[model samples]
Target: MSVFAGRFDGRVAVVTGGASGLGRETARRIAAEGGAAVLWDIDPDWLEEARKDVGAAHAIAFDVRDNAAVSSAAAETVARFGRIDILVNSAGITGATAPVQDFPVDSWLQVFAVNTHGLFYCCRAVIPQMIAQGYGRIVNVASVAGKEGNPNACAYSASKAAVIGFTKSLGKELATSGVIANAVTPATFESPILQQLPQSQVDYMRSKIPMGRLGDVRETAAMVCFMASEECSFTTAATFDTSGGRTTF
Candidate 1:
């Protein structure tokens, strides 16, 4: 009955940041469609909760920024699920908002660590497996901010922009292979990250979107699910936008 009905039957999916927000929603959709899922997150408490909610998916407490830990997690996932058909790099941090000159070095580094380095680590860990199997779908979660830089959020914007470029390069590299790599740029979504911002900042974000609203996590997850499905055969090296008309280009 679902448009994606049985599209992922018997496949295995690994979702970083699967404990919350878009990642959690995406994992649930994958599981509902009959794929075995591996949920990776740094928060063990929330990870367990999500595991129970998803019902039968594997949950692992591993920081995506830690390359060695990510590699080990990938191995464990393959051991448990046999093969990883879909990899969603959804773990990220919205670092401090400030002018570039006033931005703290620590905050900048942390943003890059989680948003950029962590994504690369996961890709490195998973690409070999995908290559060996000659099949895989990779969906990296970027942001509309990456396309048009947001004032006072230099680090977050830069990191996400880097993800877009990284996705493009990697997608081209794996174009000939059966594997597909793409990134999604979603605007302000109803997620925990909004809680960290001041009311004024949040209001400003919402006002910028022509749709006059924040995106729902489920909507973003739906797009991700489609990209990760076997039905997504010909669309690689693309950046899908779910920015509520905030991005006209």
Candidate 2:
């Protein structure tokens, strides 16, 4: 049982990339706390598995890169759950690990498509619902790479940096709307996204942490849950770090 039991008794949450990794864990936590979690992912099969594994209220399969699809998903969620109280943008991709000079153009664009543009689309679609309800919380899962750019990960780093900036602007815009927006920058951690990188790249990120260890997803989830709750009322347009002591700013 969650210590935050009943905190989200009547809330509804939409977590992108919810089939696995940070998104999946965050959804799990939200559901445990009594929130209705609506999971969105690109894979139908994985999404079903996650729905079962996380005990989500519902699941939708679609790429967040598609604005129409995101908008439709938002509508579908509200149709099923009545309101959207939380949205966690956690879908992302790390493009080819190569110096900027050698990076594949296609891979770079694809990274932005998923990591940056996709996040933007989801935010755009959900903001209207949140605004209509006069309440909502948005948590964009950025990365420490966004703060302290990692070598050979230009697309990923730059895109996440964009996420941080976007969240700041969003939070400020929604400050008085009773809708809150924030970004979380996590250091290297155990997640499916890690599998996309080379061991050397992973080691490089792990080495930058002063704590000498990667983060735990539950730790990130704890921070996310707080930010996605009414308890986070006072803060907006801020960046929360979970970099295991890697980022001081």
Candidate 3:
């Protein structure tokens, strides 16, 4: 038997944006520890890839922005897995980087649609199920940019900052309950999302981190897994930093 043989044997986990980046890595780790994972993503192609990678997990091609879709996915996940024990809100978009004056209203809206509203939708869908079970672990993926706003990425920064606030508030709301909620703020990590940015912009982001290097998605995933694990019984409503010395305190 594996070391984590029964660490999460009967638990069900849902990872939004589980097709790639930190979400993919988190799902992979959870499965390795014997948890059943429900991978939710809009990318059908990558969703297949993630399913093959996770083995025995369910994949749902759903957009987090649609309330009904999110609700349906959550319901289906519970039907398949029996209970929702963990949730990682990882679906997010880095909106167009530009000055506030040049920022497009639609772009800003899109950022919030995924980064903030999407998270809320997932939480709304899953919280009752968690409450029913009297146990749940939630990890919201925010960014160091959220903690200390980043220039040229107003929408992305603001949306993530709102996520942090939301996590804190929900954590408190469930403080007396058995549910635990927290957010992880990572510095720039090596992920496919970086391909969307210009070289100069990427370099600027790298320069801001005192660690002088980008974080690995696995590192971020590890922190997230720890928070989601039963081992983390305390430490709710906190912002756990994996920012590599960026935005310290």
Candidate 4:
């Protein structure tokens, strides 16, 4: 609600992982601002809740890891909304914490499957539609861990790092296409994702932040909404920090 109502009037946005956490906040913001938000999540129960929470334009339960699902969902969204002006890739998983040498191979693969490959699939599916429409904004959620590797989070770090690189390349490719792509690197936040990490690791992350506090999803959502808005013109293939001064570069 920080953004003025009608700022995004007549717009349509797609938020992956919009069932909960940062994604949910972003979706809710878009809807509150007179825009339509399409929420995509893998959990049907949460999807139902999110639909109510955001008055979602559309809610679909499908794993982002499934290439076919992402493709079909993109097509369905375009059909439902007529055009999608914003895309927020907010779905991700922080794999079980462990040192690189001891990180279970299965866990590593699963992390990449969702974090790296899944994002790739979503972007691949949606970019064509955006290109066709001749106007779009894409915001990929990455992490500070991607920039400064956190101890015992090898897979999560690597996956997000890939997201950063992917966004940069995609942004360049669409530079002149009236479509822009960028990635946001956020510090630790109080969200469902934190439940997946070890308490000690969480404390460690918090201590590292100069602000000595975890970020709030509301705060992250503020930055995300701006990035997805027309006000973000001239910024693409860049990394934005919602890291509480943890990242200055």
Which of the numbered candidates is closest to the native, going by highest lDDT?
2
**Which candidate has the top score in TM-score?**
2
What TM-score against the true fold does each predicted structure earn?
0.97, 0.99, 0.97, 0.98
Candidate 2: tens digits of C-alpha lDDT, residues 1-249: 998899889999999999999999999999999999999999999999999999999999998888899989999999998889999999988989999999999999999999999999999988998999899999999999999899999999999999999999999999999999999999988999888999999999888999998889999999999999999998999999988888999
RMSD of 4: 0.9
lDDT of 3 at 228: 93
After superposing candidate 1, which stretches have Cα over 4 Å from the reference? 1-3
For each candidate, what is the lDDT?
Answer: 0.91, 0.94, 0.91, 0.92
| Candidate 2 vs 3: which has more lDDT | 2
Candidate 2 regions exceeding 4 Å error are none
Error of 3 at 188 (Å): 0.4
Sort order, TM-score high to low: 2, 4, 1, 3
lDDT for each residue of candidate 1 in 1-249, tens digit (9 for 90 to 100): 356767779999999999988899899888888888789999999999998897537999988888999999999999887898999999998888778999999999999999999999999999999999999999999999899988989999999999999999999999988999999999999998777677777788899899999999989999999899877889998999998999986
RMSD of each: 1.1, 0.6, 1.4, 0.9
How would you encode candidate 4's per-residue C-alpha lDDT over 121-210 as one tens digit per residue?
A: 988988888899898999999999999989999999999999999999999999999898999999999999999988999999999999
Lowest summed-lDDT stretch of 10 residues in model 2? 63-72
